[model samples]
Structures are given as C-alpha cells and as structure tokens.
Target: MEASPARRPHRLDPAGGCPHAVNARLLARGAVTPVELPGGIEGMAVLGHAALKEFLQHPEVAKNQRHFTALREGRIAAGWPLLTFATVQGMTTADGDDHRRLRSLAGRAFTPRRVEELRPRIERLVAELLDGLERAAEAGGGVADLRRHLALPLPMSVISELLGVDVEFRDRLHHLSSVVVATDTGPADAVAANRELVAVLGEIVAAKAARPGGDLTSALIAARDEGGDRLSHQELIGTLLLMIVAGHETTLNLITNAVRALCAHPGQLDLVRAGRASWADVVEETLRWDSPVSYFPFRYPVRDITVDGTLIPAGTPVLAGYSAAGRDPAAHGADAGRFDVTRPARPGSVRHLSLGHGTHYCLGAPLARLEATVALERLFTRFPGLGLGVPEAGLTPHAGFVGNSVHALPVLLRR
Candidate 1:
C-alpha cells in the first residue's frame, strides 16, 4: 500500500506565487531593494544574510511603535492595529534599555532548567494528541487532518498550559491571534478580533494578579528586571499576549513546513526514515529551505545608514526578508533551493535568519526547537505509512505577510 514515488508531494504551484522567490530575486539584484509596505510606506528590504545581519545589528534601527514609519504617518489603515500594537509593550517590540529590561525578565522564565522540566510534559501531550489522531484515522477511513489533530493543537496546548490559560479560552485566543498575523483579514474582523484579544488578556492578567499560580503568567506578574523595574499593567497584558501567540505560531509553522518539505522529497524522507540523516538535520535544513517566518516587518533607522552600498535614510522602515536570506545563492551556493536532508555543514554557507538575530533573538527558541523535533520524530514513527491525502497543488498557502505555512495538511495516517 506504499505510495508510489511519483505520488510524492511536490513544490508549490508556479502560479500560486512564493514570497521567498520574490525576495530572492530582489536579493540577486542587490542586497537592499526599495520595497513598499501596507499604507504606502516606503522602505528598504534587507535581502541577503550579510545585509540582514548588518541590519539587525545597526544601532539606528529600533523596534518600538513610536518609530514605526507607517504608524507615525497615520497611514496604518484599519485591519492592522492589532498586529501593530498587540505586543507593543513586550520585548518583541521593545528596544534599547527597555528591551534589555523586558528581555532579561522574560529570559528568566525560559531558563534551561525550566524548559528542560517541561520536556516530559510536552512529550506526554504529543502522545495524547497522536492517540487521538490514530483514533480519528481509524474511525474516518484512514485520513486525518494533521494540521488540526497534530501540528496545531500540540504547540497551542503546550503554550496555553505554560501560561496557565484556561482550556476554554484557547479556541478564541487562537482565532484572535490568527487574525492579528494574517495580512488578508478583513478590516472589520481585525478590529473586532483586536478588541477581543486585548479584553481577554486583561481578564487573564487580572485573574493572575488576584490569585498567583505556579505558571509563567503569575511569574511575569511578579517578574522584575535587574533595575528593580517591574512590568506595568499594560506591559503584563502585552507580554502575556506576546508569549501566548508567539509561543505557538512560529513553532506551528516550523512543524508544518518541515513535514511538507520531507513529504515533497521522498528521497530525503527515505534518508530520514532509514536513519541516515538525523531529525535535527531535517529541522535545520527546513529552516533554511522553507523558513517558518517568511519576513519580519518594520525596523526603523535611528539615523541614516548605508548597507551593502545602498543608503537608507533616517526613520525609513526596513523589513528583514528572513526566508530570502535563507536561500541566498551567494551565501548558500547555487543549490540553495534543493531540499536536501544530507546537506553538508559547509563554510561560507548562509546561516538561516528564520529565528532573528543579535540581542532580540527569539527567547523561546529552545522550547520551539524541542517541540518541533519531538513532534516530527514521534509523528513519522507513529504513522510510518503517512502520505498526502490531498495533492500538493491543492494545498492552501498561509495567507499572511509573514509565515510560510500551509492552511492544512490532509494526510493519510496509514496507506
């Protein structure tokens, strides 16, 4: 009952349009390209790894809303205020001394010991989810929607439990968070979702304040930086919202993208299945080939700066094309687009920018990586006969300015 070689999942459709390809073409022309964002905001898209690293390290570049060119110009239109301001007070959007303070306090919550302690719990949750998937497949003609049954719920559950978010509120939170990141959401929907997200976060913050629990939310309620500065009420709500949303979104994409990459290349999957290539290798290669985050938005220059022979004026919004940098031919050579699990760790090869860089690098990286590695390995092992239930061309791409994920992965749990 094995799927034939010709039945393997293939690359995305040519007509569907790939943001990574667009960015790669831009990078090939030059390290920096003039790009326009929503609201008619003009900025330079930093393309290759060299330009991306330099852009991240540039002192003039800041992450706060006060410096957002589009917001400041009053051009940020409707349908985006949620994403623009959702994490406005969290470390994700803070810069300078404020960034350091927020990051330091949040960092304590994700220490090595804390993350390690959660591994057993994560594994248990994965097992429980897979058991449900198996049951669904058994009762429903051998098919399963891996995205919902496995990829989607695992990270959300892990993060929700980590933050002590009640199970009942999870579905609503997921909807709001999805709208915030989605570029294609309608204006009315975005506005309503934004309001609901803020209200929900406020409720959670108040509850945690009244009754401290053994959870990250409670810890953040009490968390203070080295300077004796604690998070404000707004900061607490923003930080918790950021943690809950970010904790799952990126990792969800990572798992989905990795699985799709493997299924698309049967030979590579065989290597992984045969134990020739490690799961860690699969994870790293996927990050390079199909980055979870397609591009990150709006880093404003504190002052005019020249990058890769291009001059970016002060306060100009600079967007980092992380997915494009991952496949930069100059950095990763001509075969950068090939999905190879056996790819060598060669010198001069471009290191992936999927997870950000420098001081503001993703804080939950370890937990994300661990969740992905465990999820993928256990998934394939539990369902060795898995194959695409829907054609590759039919799979829907994630509809967002950032994130490279499919809408759903309809998979055969058993051949």
Candidate 2:
C-alpha cells in the first residue's frame, strides 16, 4: 500500500537497511513520501533525483534544530537514537548565517590547495595500507576483509592525522561514532554514545587550546572573529566531532562501496583495463551507484512545506534520500540500475547530490574524492586479480537506515 499521508508515512525498510530497496518502494509511491524513523518518529523522505535536488536547495527548509518544534517542545523524548542529528551544534545541524559561519571556519583546511597537498600524504598512506592488506592476505591464505585492512583505516588515519586526533582516541571515537550514526542502536546506548562523543571531542578541543599545533583542530581553536563572532566551546567541540565522523565515515564507505561495486561487476573493471574508463570514472560511478550516506538526517522546515503535493509538516525532520536519488530511474533512465562506468552525465543538473548541493554542501568533498580515487587506482593496480571471497548474498547491510553499506567486505587478493 502507498503511504497513507505525510502524517503517517509508510514504513520504510527497518529490518534490512538497503537503500535501493527502500528507494524502489518510496519511488514507486512518489517523489516525496512520509516514512517512519526508527524510534516511531514520523518524517518525510525525498527519494527522487529531481525532487531531492530541488528540496536540498529549498529556501523554505533549514537544518537548524531551533525550527524543529517537536524537539523544542520536548515531544522528542530524551535517549532517542536520532537525537544526535538534531541536537549537535555542528554545521551539519546549522543553517542560514550560522551555517555559513561554521562552514567558513572549517573550509580553510579543505581548500583545493590544501586537499591537493594531502594527495602525496594520501598516496603514502595508501601504499602503507596496501602493505598491510598484503600481510593480511598472506596470514589469511590470500583472503582478507578489505574494509578492515584498508578502507576503514585509510580515511580514519587521514582525518585523525589532519585533525591531530591522537591514535589512542581513534578506535574509541570510531566505536562511539558508529553507534551515533546507526539507527538500530538501542536507546540507552545511543544516549551514552552521544554524550561520550561530546566528552571525547571536548577533551580534544581542550588539548588543542592548551598547546596548539599546525593542525585543523588547532587552527579552529585559534580562529577568532571581531565583534564577538567566534566558535564557542560547544561549537568548537561539535566541529571536531563533525570533522571526525563526516570526514572519516563517509569516505571510508565511499572507498568500500567503490571496491565492492568494481569487484561485483568485474566487467566494469575490464572496461577500466581496456582504457574505456579511468579510476576517476570508477569513483564517480561508484558514488552514483552506491552512495555512502543513504538517508542524511534532519533538515527541518520552518513552516509546513509541500513538495509535489506531499505535505511535510513544519518541524518534522526531512531525511535527504541520497542513495535513492542516485539510482532514480526517472532522471537516470531505465538502465540507471545497471552500473556503467561510461554512464553519460545528465546535462543541466549537477552529476549527483551524493556529496550534497548548495550551501550545506560537504566541506571535505574534494578530500573524499581525492582519497577514493587514489585508493582505488592503487588498490586495483596492486592486486589485479582481487575478487569477492564470499557470495554476493553473504555481504550484509549495516543495521542502520542512515548509513548504506555492507558491514564487512571479504575479498581474495588472488584467485
């Protein structure tokens, strides 16, 4: 049955966190469909390519929590798993001038020049990680979980090094961050994770303030504004948390998804081998094929808003259905479901909103693209015969609606 109404959105894929499945169901209903969040929370999902792009740039909507009436009125109870997205003071939850202010400060470390400069370091890191992967395969008799051996560590190390997050805190933060993003996390654990995430980041910010270094954390700490415009203590910690989670998690999955896609569709890898496509094509296609972030959370409408006849009540969180938009058949054509490295770009529109659009666009996008591209090129070159060690069905989706990726990807370095 179709969604009854925006007030009672159709139930989405709760047991399985497959975006394509969810997208297919929601897309069949309409461009904008109301859906139920994990905690019995009602929200709207924009799953169409055209409609999602429009709403992402919609002037009527804002991501700031102040506009969320349910939250402000305490209707959204404490310990809700989705509260982190709503209560976090980072740019992800900020809108308007506040967003601009926060984004401006964080953007300094991720400029084209800065991101390009990291290319050399990233290459070195990729090389080292490949060595680790080789060791893992040797120990495992030519089998390895690439996600654990390579994909996860690459971005985690890069972001941690860039932000100067200590190695000691990396694993701790990763565990906490995983819980914070996963929808299926239990209420009590979710609340504890959110609180501990803030506490951990607060310690990082405090350390940076005491003895600053030539790192993003120190730079953000030192950034000041005339007329009392500055990143407050809470905002500073939130920014660090945002950088760690957004910077690492998104790119980790991007690399993982790209590798998974290429391995699953070896013909696409053959195309790259025949000079029909480049690693850049692989990266972009993977993004369009299996977007890392599935349903980016919590863009609230200041007033009741209607998109293509579906009404999203004011103050209800609107999840951006990015993974759905990536594979929308309407905009991408009937063959959209098939992964094509040579897929033609849709004219007059941005390639895809995987990295988002307009003002709230991801600040670390360049870095992410660079990391994925370099990592893929080096990985494929280093392990020419790499293939999945397990059946396709063996790959399991993470138990979270917001993040779309398999929990683990096992592969054979050589068959």
Candidate 3:
C-alpha cells in the first residue's frame, strides 16, 4: 500500500526549543503548508528554499498590513499574541515606493562601506564588553550569562550609538524590546510595551531634532526638516524603534548562536582555533544552522498566490520560515542539520535565508555580520576555554517565536 501524506504542524509553538527541528518536519509536507499561528490563527508558512526565494520577490506579495484582509476587516481579535508584528509601523511594513523612499534615507547612511568604517568602534565595544564579562565572572561566583554580558550588550550599544540614544535610554529600551519579541507576552502587555517603546523612541527622536548631532537619528531629522521626499513624524519614530530593537536583537542572536554552536561542537571549535576555518565561516554557518529569527509573520498576498500546489488566499498572512529555510535539506543537502563551520558554498542553492531576501531583506545585515564577527573573535580570544555553564539540555530557549536563541547563554568564562 502507498504511504499516507505527512501531516502538517497542528500549531506552531513560537516558544518551543527547536525551530529547526520543527522545520525538518514541515519539509516533508511540501514547501508550503498551512500552519496554526498562535491564538488559533491560520496562516501559510514557506519552509523550502526555492519556493521561498521565488515568492519573496513575487510582485503580488506585499509587506503592508493594509493587504491583510483579516486585520483590515476586524476578523482578528484584540490582544492577539502576535499583534506586535502587525501593529509596529515603519520600514518593516512599508512596500513599493514607500519602502524605497524610507529605505533610501537609512540605506545611504548604512551602506557596507559605512558599516565597515564602524569596525574600530565595534572592536572597542567588543573589548569593553569582554572586560565586563570577566569582571562579572570574578565577582559573581564563576559563571556569567554570555547572552547578557556579551551578546546582548554588544549590538545594543552599537545601534544605540548609531541612533544617538544615550546610555540611560538603552536599559528600558532593551526591556521593552524583549517584551515585544516574546511569544509568551499576553496581548495587553505586548501592546503596552509597543506603545511605551514608541513613546520613548518618540522622545529620543524629538531630542535629536531639537539638538542635532552626528548620528543617524539626526540625519533622519535632517531628512524630515529639508522636506522633499521625507519621513513623517510617525515614520521617523517607527524607523528609530525598528532600528534600535531589531538591529540590536538580530546581532545579539547571531553572536549568541555562534557561541553556542562553537561550544557545543568542539570539533567545529577546533576548526576555528586550528586556523582551518575563519571567524567568517562561523558566522555564515551559524546563520544557516540556527537563524536568529525562526518565523516572521504577516507577508500579505496582494492577491491569491500558490506555491507547490498550496493555495494561499489573498490577504492571508504568510510566515517566512527563516529558521526552516536554513535547515532545508533540499537547499543545503542531507547534512543540513549538522553545524559545520566549513560548509561549502553551493553555487546555485540558497546559501542561507538568515539575513533574508529581495526588497524586505534586512538592511542591517552587514552591520550585524561585522558586529558578530568581531564579538565572536574577541570573545574567544579573551576566554579560550569558554564553555556552557549548564548542560546544553538545561539551556532555556528564548521565549519568543521571532528570536531563535536561548533565554540566557550561561557560560564558564575560565578553565
């Protein structure tokens, strides 16, 4: 008798430990499958490489929530756990002409050349963070949370510096940002956090406007002041919020995931230390092996679109399975599940969907990579014998769907 079809995931647990494992199951059920979003929501998730790559650039697809029919018609309930994705407005939600216009303002300031120029600053920050970790370990027993001491603060400082937010603003911003990304947050708390983040960022944007300085926030203010094609007040605040939180979080995960990968796989760690694989290799492999983001929500179809015979109705939310795409055996071969620093580059296959694709791709990709590379290299150089403080099984996953990292990356910083 012929085998029955593989079952699609009943519901996606954003707070679950392993998104890659979930993605592996989904792969057997074709590229596109209907997934149960949190709160009994139904949506399509694209897990395969080729389908994801093709559809990401599809002309009929859009990022704007206006295209989301359920939301537009009030079918979605209030206080939904995933409401943060739909509500936060800025570069992330814009499309077509608006996206290009908004992206241009920051893009000009954040080109790869400019990101590279920040290397010295990034390096300095990495060194300082490393010092803090050492001090933390010395003061508080023998272990420090690497995610907190190093991974969390490195990119947070870099992005805040870029945006001109003072040291005082970062702690609150970090807390609120965490709330928004967390899957466990109730709808009330999540929306509340988003509002507070917006308000705080609004104040910062205003401060930059009143007292202009040599920062991206000031540059954006200048764009608004010299009014041809410019950012509206809402857009300005939204953009700042997006950059600070999203920028900080993505790099944080990149650094955290890299460290975890290296520590967990001693042979892979050997490859890096023995001069066989470079730090860049670690970054690339980590991105593929464990993407910072698992599944991002709500890519509304402008009209009906089909992938691999699965019908995605227009205005339906299509989740981008970045974590899934990374482990797609179809794209990375049978051993895609393994974390190898020296994974060879595939000529025509999707190398990694961690950074993303097409217009909605991450603008902060280069900066994230630069920060992770420096952070990883400097971190290991400081503590060659760094290892997980707790057993790998004991490590708690970040309690959020969007972030694919642990809640706390506890590490023993000395031999």
Q: lDDT for model 3, on a 0 to 1 scale?
A: 0.85
> Tens digit of lDDT per residue, candidate 1, span 82-192?
345423578878987888877876787677688888889999999999999888888778877788888889989988988888888898898888887676666788788
- Report, for every candidate in turn, its global Cα lDDT versus the true structure: 0.77, 0.86, 0.85
Ranked candidates (TM-score, high to low): 2, 3, 1
Reference-based lDDT, residue 65, model 2: 89
Worst 10 residues of 2 by lDDT: 1-10
Candidate 1, pairs of clashing residues: 60-302
Instruction: Write the residue-wise lDDT of candidate 2 on 182-237 in tens digits.
Output: 77777789888988988898788778778889998888887642327778777888
How close is every model to the real structure, measured as TM-score? 0.91, 0.96, 0.95
What's the alpha carbon RMSD for model 3? 2.5
Question: Could you tell which candidate, 1 or 2, scores higher by TM-score?
Answer: 2
**C-alpha-based local distance difference test score of model 2:** 0.86
Cα RMSD for candidates in order = 7.6, 2.3, 2.5
* Model 2 TM: 0.96
lDDT of 3 at 65: 83
Model 1 worst lDDT run, 10 consecutive residues: 3-12
